[model samples]
Target: MLSLLDVFTPAAPVWSVDDLIRYSGSPPSTCYRYLKVLCGAGFLARVANGSYVLGPRILELDRTIRLCDPVYVAGTSIAQHLTDSLGYSTLLCILFSDSVMCVQQARSRDAPPQLFNRGQRRPLIAGASAKAILAHLPLHQLRSIYAKNRKDIASGGLGSDWEHFKRALKQIRSDGYCMTVGEYNPGVMSIATGLFNRDGEVLGSLAMVAWAENSDITAFRTLTPEVVRAGQEISARIAATENMMDLPARAIG
Candidate 1:
């Protein structure tokens, strides 16, 4: 059931009943049963053209996550504070699968229009935010991603081969952050640091963006420490929240 729902994306927002059956490789009766269940549960809705789109229930769930999820709650405040203090647009990105999704954004008054917005997904090897998270992933996962996206990795200048790619990510880990210029978008610069869960698993990244014209290489370095600090603070807050949630109800109270 969840697999059917996963077929809907920004690029393919609607699906006909036939489309679902073809994609799922299920018989017509089974597909219809599943679709009926999903529609009844309000996770899918029939559109004017008889295709299905994600229903309003998804919006409700998104709102709940934005309000209650520890990473979103912590990232939102920290991103806004960084934008206000640093005068650059800030992005809070989360890693899911091989993509990084922007979950929170705070725009500075004078900053250039942001290339990424909330809910937009970018390749894991494309930008500073993605690289910051990618650098911390386990070796096995990193190897898998590199094997699948070797061309993109090379084109993005991350590395020409697997060994070089590992070296590049290692450098990011050593520095505690990633910085890039015109990587994802033309003439834009991004500096990002990784956010982690209580077990030190990579959760996402917090990044600040500025126009390259207004930001020099030397100036970009100065901002990395602040962004890295913000990332650490966000990770600490999420860990604290996780710890609280793990406590017994009576103990928490």
Candidate 2:
């Protein structure tokens, strides 16, 4: 059921009971019962055509969670600063168990037409923000995520240039930042760096996205340091939070 929540949350407004049943590997009757219960509890809603969409309750919960999210609280100012300084939209994203979830986003006064918003999800292999987080993930875990999301990769929807992607991740790990162009969206470019807690566990990534027409090598050079600094600042703030105090202990064990 929790898995259902994870799947549905990321895919809200576009999912159906059949998809849920297929994903969960549950019997039709069981899946139907679960969906009925979820709808009754205001977790899922039945649309006009019989498709299921996420209910208003989920939005209320998401709003509350976003407001209280430690990373979002810590990164909001930095994201705004980056947007103001770079004249590009900035985003803060965290890997929520199996998917990368946007927590906060700020658009520059000069943001491009294709700029994305908070709560958007991008493939882990398709964008700089996702690559930044992926670079910090343990090798085994990264491989596992790739294995699980292979279909998205193979369909050319996630920019899965296997060799190129792997090499880029290696470079990101070594350089402490990631950059992408025309991977997720054509004519869109981004640069990102990972944020970590005191224990060095990755907490999230901070990214700056701009139109390709305005983004050149010079722009990358200019934004790289600022992005890295913002990531480091957020990491330090997260490290100081009480919730992160046990991270090191858990890592050690």
Candidate 3:
């Protein structure tokens, strides 16, 4: 099943059983059975033209899981406050299992026309939010994430230079914030700080994104302290509610 999922990952949103079989290099009978089970389990849906796409069930499950995420539940007001204060778009994102998922977002009154709808999944190695989260991850886990998405990174969907990404993560770890320029979206600049839970475990990241022309890199650097403070404030709130201490020392690196 893991191999099958790996085979389908690149072809997601629009693929067929034949494509899956070809990618997996598996026999027709086995591939058909696997596809049938996946469809029956609501992992895939047959479109009007009989092509397979992701099903609503995956979304439904994703929603359910997100609802239970403490970071999503707690970060809404923080995001709103930050956006309101900074006049830039703010987003709350978490590493949802294997993918980084946006759970909440707030847009400033003068935010850009490009809408960042909730539930969007940006690349972990490219965008500020994902990079902030990735910065604190243990090295082995970071390697795994990079390996899993190597194809996309190599294809230029992520940053143009992989070495630059490595250097950026290192700087993020030292600086307590991550910044990006046109890494995720052209002409969009962003700064991000990672949020922690009661156990000091990285729960997610909070980010502010603005137009490249209007944002100054130095101004973005100045915003880092505020972003870190906000993240810590939110973390303390979660800790008070959960009544636990001693941050987990686990590192993805």
Tell me, by lDDT, which candidate is best.
Answer: 1
User: What TM-score does candidate 2 get on C-alpha atoms?
Assistant: 0.75
For model 1, the superposed segments whose C-alpha errors exceed 4 Å read 1-3, 6-15, 18-25, 242-253
Of the candidates shown, which would achieve the greatest TM-score relative to the real structure? Answer: 1
Report how far residue 138 has shifted in candidate 2, in Å: 1.0
Give each model's whole-structure lDDT.
Answer: 0.85, 0.75, 0.72
TM-scores of the models, in the given order?
A: 0.86, 0.75, 0.70
**Local accuracy of candidate 2 as per-residue lDDT tens digits, 108-219:** 7656676666777665666788878877777677667667766665564433655654665678889988877767788878888997877788877898888878767665
lDDT of 1 at 159: 96
Task: Pull out the clashing pairs in model 3.
Answer: 137-252, 137-253, 138-251, 138-252, 138-253, 139-252, 139-253, 199-247, 199-248
Q: In what order do the candidates fall by lDDT, top score first?
A: 1, 2, 3
Compose the digit string of candidate 1's lDDT tens values, residues 52-146.
Answer: 99998889999987877666887898899989987889999888677898888888766766568888888888989999989998888888888
**Which residue pairs clash in candidate 1?**
none
The total number of steric clashes, by the backbone 3 Å criterion, in model 1 comes to 0
For model 3, residues 1-253, the per-residue Cα lDDT tens digits are 4356543454366776677778768798887887788888888778887677766777888787566566766778887898888778888887655556787888876665664567666666667787788777766776776767777655543444557546656787788887777777788777888888765677778888888777777776677777788887777776766533335333333
Which run of 10 residues does model 3 get worst, by summed lDDT?
A: 243-252
> In the order shown, what is each candidate's alpha-carbon RMSD?
5.4, 5.1, 5.3
Number of clashes recorded per candidate: 0, 0, 9
